[model samples]
Target: MQAFLQQLPALIGVVIGALASFAATSAAERSRWRRTQSVRWDERRLTAYAEYASAVKKVISLSVRIAAHRGIHPDIDALPPEEGLPALAAAEEERTVKWETVLLLGTGSTVVAARAWHESAFRLQRIASGREVELSWSEAIDAVSKARRRFYEAAKADIGIALGDVPESYDWQISRLIAADSTPPERNT
Candidate 1:
C-alpha cells in the first residue's frame, strides 16, 4: 500500500502529460483545419472574381466591336450589328451567369465594385445598341475603365494582395486618336 501510494504521483503526472499532449495536438489540428478552409475559400473567391471579370470583359469587347461598326470606336475593328449583336447578347448572358458566382463568393466591397463595373459595361452595351444617345462613347469607355480599376482594387484587397494602385492606361485614347486621323474600314451591316 505504501508503494502504490508513492507511485500515485508518477501515474498522475503521466496522465496529465498525456492530456496536455492531446490538447496541444487538438489545438494544432483545429488551427490547421481553419487555415485550410480559409485558403480554400480564398481560392474560390479568386476564381469567382476572375471569371466574373472575364465575362464582363467579353461583353465589353463585343459591345466595343459593335460600337466600332457604328463608327463610335474607330480604333477597334467593326463587327456589323448582324454579327455583333448576337455575340454581344451571348456575352451578356455569360456575364450574368458568372455574376451569380461572384455574388456567392465575393466580399461585400468586391461585390459592390463588381456591380458598378458591370453596370458601366451595361452602359456601353446600351450605347452600342443605340438605346443610349446622351452618353458619349468615349465617356462610357472611360467610366467602364474606372469601374474596372475599382473592381480590381477591391478584389485584390479581398484576396490580401497589397499591391499599390493599379496603373491607368491611356493607350485606348492614343489608339483612337491615331485611328481617327485615318479613315475607318467600311462596315457592311
Candidate 2:
C-alpha cells in the first residue's frame, strides 16, 4: 500500500504530460489543415474573379463591336449579343464551380454587381433576339454599352484586389503594382 501511494504522483504527472502533448499535436494539425483550406479558397476566389472578369470583358468587347456597327464604338462591328450570352453564362458557371470559395475569399460586392450587370446584359440580348423586343435596337445597344463599361471598370478594380492583379482597363492599378525594378505582384505571388 505504501509503495502504490508513493508512485501515484509520478503516474499522474506522466498522464498529464501525455495529455498535453496530444492536445498540442491536435492543435497544430488542425491549424495546418485550416491554412491549407484557406490557401485553396484563396486560389479559387482569384480564379473566379479573373474568369468572371474575362467573361464580362468579352461581353464588353462585343458591345464595342456592336456600337461600332451603330457608329458608337470605334471601328467595331463584331457583336452578336444573342449568341454571346449563352457562352458567357457557361463561362460564369465554370468559373464559379466552387461557391464557398467566392463567398469566403472574394468580395461579395463584386459578385453582386457582376450578377446585376449580367442580368441587364441578358435583358438587352433578349431585346436583340427574343419573343418580342421590349426595347428598341438602339436602346438595347446603348444599355449593353453602359453595362459593359461598368462591368469592365468594376471587374478591373475587384480582380486587382482578388488576385493581387490589375484589371486590363485600370491603368492605375497596373502601375501601382508594377515594381520599378521588380516584377508585378501577381507574377511574384
Candidate 3:
C-alpha cells in the first residue's frame, strides 16, 4: 500500500504530460487543415480570375478586328469584314461561360470588377457590331482600357500580389493596347 501511494504522483505526472502532448498535436492538426483550405481556395480564385480576364480579352480583340474590318475603324482593319462576324459571336459565347465561372468563384470585390470589365467590353462590342449606339474607335478603346486597368488593380488587391510583381507579359499587353489607341493606325502600303 505504501509503495502504491508513493508512486501515485509519478503516474499523475505521466498522465498529465500525455494529455498535454495530445492537445498540442490536435491543435497543430487543426491549424494545418485551415492553412490547406486557405491555399486551395486561393488557387481556385486565381484560376477564376485568369479565366475570366482571358476570355474577356479575347472578346475585346475580336471586337476590335470586327470594327476595323467593317470600316468603323478603317485604318486598323486586320481581317476581312465578312470574316469577323462569326468570330466575334464565338468569342462572345466563350466570354459568357467564363463570366459565369467568375460569378461563382470570385470574391465580392473581384466580382464587381469583373462585371465592370465585362460591361465595358460589351459596350464596345455592341458599337463595333452595330447592335447599338455608335462610338469612335478611340472612344471605345479608351473606355475598355480604363475598365481593364480597374479589373487588374482589383485582382491584384484580392490576390495579395503586389502590382510590381505582376507578370511583365500582362503589363506589356495592356500597355500595347493603350498605346495602339494613342495614335491612328498607319495605312498599309
Candidate 4:
C-alpha cells in the first residue's frame, strides 16, 4: 500500500502533463485549420462574387439600353428587331452557368440572395429579348433594378478577401449603385 501511494503522485503528474500537451497541440491545430479555411473560403467567395457581378451588370446594361431605346422610339416602334435580342439570350444562358458556380461557392445568405436576383434578372432579360412575353415593361425593369441592388448588397456584405482591395475602376457605375441602394441594414447584416 505504501509503495502504491508513493507511485500514485508520479502517475498523476504524468497523466496531467500528457493531457496538457494534448490540449495545447489540439488547440494549435484547430487554429491553423480555421485560418487555412478562412483564407480559402475568402478567396473562393470573392472570385465567384466578382464573376457573378460582372455577368449581371452586363445584362443590366443591355436591359437599360433596350429600355432607353424603347423610350426614344415610339411606343409602337418597339426595340429594333436586331441582333441585340439574340445576344441577350446568349448572355442569359451564360449567366446561368455563372450563377450556378456562385451558388456552389458562396455562403448561405449570399446564395439565397443570388438566386432571387438571378431569377428576376432572367425574367427581365427574356422579356427584353422578345423571347418571352411580359404584361408590363415597367414591372420587368423594376424587378431587374431590385435584383441588381440585392445582388450588390449580398456581395458587398460578404467578408471575401479580394472585396477588401477591389479596384475602384472596375465598375464605377456598379459601385455607385451599390452605395446608393444598399442600406446599412441590408449590408451590415
* CA-only RMSD, every prediction: 3.3, 11.5, 3.6, 9.5
Best by TM-score: 1
Residue 18 Cα positional deviation in candidate 3, in Å, after optimal superposition: 2.0
* Residue 26 accuracy (lDDT) in model 4: 100
Q: Write the per-residue lDDT of candidate 4 for residues 34-106, one digit (tens) a residue.
A: 9999889878788888888788766666654454344421122234427557666667777777888887888
TM-score, every prediction: 0.85, 0.53, 0.79, 0.65
The best-first sequence of candidates by lDDT reads 1, 3, 4, 2
Q: Which ten residues in a row have the lowest lDDT in candidate 3?
A: 180-189
lDDT of 3 by residue, 93-167 (tens): 988998888788777888888888888888878877767656566666777777787788788777777767555
- Which ten residues in a row are the worst by lDDT in model 1? 170-179
The global Cα lDDT (0 to 1) of model 2 is 0.52
Model 1: number of backbone collisions: 0
Q: Which of the predicted structures, 3 or 4, would earn the higher lDDT when compared with the native?
A: 3
Candidate 1 residue 119 Cα shift, in angstroms, is 0.2
Poorly placed runs, candidate 3 (over 4 Å):
1-5, 74-77, 134-136, 165-189
Candidate 1: where are CA atoms >4 Å away? Answer: 169-189
Q: 1 or 3: which has the higher TM-score? A: 1
Per-prediction count of colliding residue pairs? 0, 0, 0, 0
